[model samples]
Target: MAIRLRVLLALGCALLTAGCASGSEMTFRQDKRLTIVSPGTGKTVRLPVKVSWTMRDFTAVRAGSPVRAGTGYYAIFLDKYPMAPGKSLGSLVTNGDCAGVSGCPDAAYLAQHLNVFVTSGTSYTIDAVPSSGTLGSSSHYLTIILVDGAGRRIGDSSWTTSFTVAGAAS
Candidate 1:
């Protein structure tokens, strides 16, 4: 009877392990690319512009409290300069906790000047209108980047394009 009980326990453990092993393995690649689809470079457009884009290889997943592998989100940097491609964007620090971080701005500052967070999607269309009275007619640079589950930047960092806000002084 004891031998039978031990066999049953061992079988259960093996089944659990086998079940886990059957799931798809995580794969990593360095060839992911992001391309802006609308707002042709240097094109003049009005406010509340529609921005669209496409991505390859990367998977978009809702960001949870705990980040998961191969799943993350995207951020749009409007009119903000971009870091060099492949450079690391360290921890995402907001105004509430900008201590010791150079160039760190608070949440309100970012919200007004930067769209630090956007929803996760393989392809997305965003209605981008600068907050009322926030931006004058001017040429602005837009950049898109992929951030991993851990809030770390992945893929090329300098994927940027530019467009002019119609009527904004060039």
Candidate 2:
């Protein structure tokens, strides 16, 4: 009976491990130019931005570009969560928290047809504030990436910042 129990346990463990490893790990790159500004406190932190990407079962791909998926077939996801440690995540998707880890994801964010409150071409301008009108924490991190059906990485982005929370209205 013990032998049978051990065999069952081993099989269960194997299945779990296989499931976790089924997804291919993506590669990430970073841009050195990063700027984070705080409002009331008037503080700013300068840092770098990193990006991750994954692709799988792509129907087509541009040279040196991410593989492509047919319409309604699949879509690329950018981890809006920082994917970095000590980073906080928000329901608003303004921050990411899966940093420095592989296969461990926080939230899957779609890069298509999503609202990006940014001034620059592709950056989002986050404007979250506290009701007190008092300046508090500053900025949040966001992850951006692309992938194909084959679960291979194409590209991505990452950044962290501090911002002053707004105070209550007068």
Candidate 3:
């Protein structure tokens, strides 16, 4: 009787532990894709253009919120590739204001530009305004990644698209 009771107790504990595991502990599906819908690749556009994209199979949530299974936020990468797994999106430069600023200022600027929380829907739009004084023509690359609550990138665009910024130059 004692041995049987111990076995039952151990089984109960194992089930409890499994149930307590957070969503972050589970493996996220990689079948989702992030696609840029606006300002198509190789196209020329004026300043203050609208950038849009679509994501599938992943639930979009507000940053800093409790992460749910299969739910996360988006991070925009401009002119750079997405960070590797386990890298924090906060380290990347996503806006022009980050220049000449150190520490919090830089982080604040990046936070504003890079991390985009989708309150609802799979499609999102953001404005891209040129900060460069002169912009006769410039090639800009954009990509996005889906990050879990822990700031780990779980999904990303396979390719970065290039678009030209015209009329921004003096």
Task: Encode model 1's per-residue lDDT on 1-170: one tens digit a residue.
Answer: 99999999999999888867533574444443677777789787786667778877668865442566556777667765444444433443334456776545533444444554355764444345453222344766677777665445665544666777776443
The candidate, 2 or 3, that scores higher on TM-score is 3
Report the Cα lDDT for residue 1, model 2: 100
Clashing pairs in 3: 134-169, 135-168, 135-169
What do the candidate models score in CA lDDT, each in turn? 0.59, 0.32, 0.60
Worst 10 residues of 2 by lDDT: 70-79
> Each candidate's TM vs. the true structure?
0.56, 0.25, 0.57
lDDT of 3 by residue, 44-79 (tens): 877665667777777777656576778877666665
TM-score of 2: 0.25
Clashing pairs for model 1 are: 95-106, 95-107, 137-168
Candidate 1 ranges with C-alpha deviation above 4 Å: 1-32, 65-69, 82-110, 122-137
Clash tally for model 1: 3
Worst 10 residues of 3 by lDDT: 128-137
Worst 10 residues of 1 by lDDT: 85-94
lDDT value for model 3: 0.60
Cα lDDT tens digits, model 2, 28-134, are 45544333222212334232222222233323332223334431111222223322322222223333543555532322332322322111123333333322322
Q: Model 3: what TM-score?
A: 0.57
